[model samples]
Target: MAGRRRSGGWRALLCLPLAGAFSLTALSGCGPVPAPDDPEGRDGRAVQRMLDQRAAAVRERDADAFLATVDRGSAGYLAEQRRVFRQMSAVPLRSWTYRLVRTGGFEPARVGGRSLAAQVELRYRLKGYDTAPVVSAQYLTLARRGGQWYVASDDGVVDGKRGTEQLWDQGTVDVVRGAHSLVLGVGQDRRVLRAVADTADRAVPVLGHVWPQEWAGRVVVEVPASLGRMAALLGASADGYRGIAAVTTGEVGGAGDETPADRVIVNPEAYQVLGDFGRRVVITHETAHVATRTATSASTPLWLSEGFADWVGYRTPGRTPRQIAPSSPTPSPPGTCPPRSRATPTSASAATPTASPAPMNRAGSPAA
Candidate 1:
């Protein structure tokens, strides 16, 4: 959970990368290796060729070519793979890539002792959805049939664990793209989806005016149907997320020039209860965190960060604390009141002025 540190002006929760037996390396292209006369060497080369074919099929979105890479002998596996392909076809993908991390030594298979297995990392991104590629480690078992190596099992569990499912696997999500924003949501509520899109439309220009132009001014907001789904997306426990309206999550450090895969996740239940004004406040506050994501660090105080966002959100609404607090009696005191104690100007308390506090909820907590 090192990635989950609250160091970047927002609370973060990082999912653990799928672990495997092979040493990790950045994906890169490699030249073809010369064929060896040894049987083991020949088998390894054949497996690598099969893997390259599979990767190419995914990139090209060729269903026939993809299916050809799988072993046809296993009818059950092939059928399930067909279903997965159908699901993937429904979603428009921006890019898909697979890298062969390592090829393990030839091992015995269920059919006979002529099969081999390898581990690989698959990374992909969906159009108008994912900002960065999602990575997963998969175990693949291959077998030689008709003088060709075909994938016998694509998802063999390593260390008794399987990789996390892709976003498309969770459920059907409708994507709406604006000039400067991409909004993704589940379910059939087109009205709610349009409302989110409209809010993002109004927010982008305001954010551009209020924040530095270091970022591209592009934002992606995800509104899951339930808080449970939101928790799953942020890699946090549902119980820990109670009463939270929204959160900004992504990778922290990089070149600090381009925006990373940061996204604003809205708590569905809490957000549904908010009226127009409240919705704007919450969205703008979260967007502020996204705009300043690269600048804010772990050392930034939460109060200052949250306070600035609150100020930006409430500044233009023309609502004052006194107007909100109608029940409180207005006290008319003398212009100059007697000092209670002789506090020095350099003192911490003396340096700070007591101003009217922001409106709070019935539970005495500040509203987002």
Candidate 2:
């Protein structure tokens, strides 16, 4: 879920940092712990109640009620939260909820009143957009004021690590709604966002043709200002993400329920260098991952998953490999590539139509 990083300490549990294209990993970092209290669970219940109200406020779009959950005495934190809520207005949320993970996950040295550091998890979905919820790890410094708990500061550290950067945290969120997409950008031009939406809108139908499953048919894209900002949002060093055009966040394998819509985070710098044909290929390729990966497990071989995506992406006849990667050397043959054991994507070629990609076993190979 992270693109990942240490926030002041409440970072999301993460796996599979991406490379030039994309990668998939399951999320199961934080485990549930018993209630903080021995029997009554009064203190834990109170904190959860306050958090419930906070989640309700966002769902209902009530600023005053939203602010009520925060410590009123903390002027600086209160003001900052005011701005965060206002920015959220542009984005649409279908569901929002908080689950208490564990108490005493961390200790905040300096606080105004009675404080308890807890690890929390936030699950939220964009209305008419997301199929499953996007999960985030939360750290809270809860304050007991007048016998009730108020969120003192969520920016606190958990286990000496901080959380990832959120889309809203960047700046004023500029939302562009395409027929089949929702583009959210910060410190980016409106024209750039619309183009992203248009590209995504076009990709959805193409995905439907090859991907035999139900999907939201739409995607939510996060467009940060620069490559560095993109890396920060992913919580990684710029070096790892430097030339990578984009990355997707979603479950690798799970078909019984509709998988969540992927957040196709774009690297503006790298993406811009890709011309019209190049841009279409990349966006379409990533969207195909969103569609086809519902049945792919973490143990699925890179060849099968990526090769499947490549198969779906470069569907146009006579397309060449150089057009996809640009920097790679051309294959010896003009329109076709050399054969291999499994259908993994090669630098100079895309997967063929008959390449037998199928259900994967934990050993990273096709099942019998």
Tell me each candidate's RMSD, in Å, in order: 14.0, 14.3
Give the per-residue lDDT digits (tens) of candidate 2, residues 1-368.
12122431232232223222222322333322334532225567777888889999999999999999888777777888899899878888889998877677577434686788767888888888887887777787877889888877777675455665678877889999999889999989999999999988888889888887776688788899988888777666777666566777777777633454467888888777766655666677778777766778778888887777666666765765554344433455877776554444554233221223211101111110
Which pairs clash in the backbone of model 1?
Answer: 7-298
TM-score: which candidate is best? 2
lDDT of 1: 0.60
Residues forming the 10-long window of minimal summed lDDT in candidate 1: 359-368
Q: What's the residue-level lDDT of 168 in candidate 2?
A: 85
Give the poorly placed runs of model 2, Cα more than 4 Å off: 1-40, 256-261, 317-368
Residue lDDT tens for model 1, 175-260: 77777777777653878877877887777678778776566576777778787877766544777666566777654444342333
How displaced is residue 240 in candidate 1, in Å?
2.5
In candidate 2 the C-alpha lDDT for residue 328 amounts to: 39
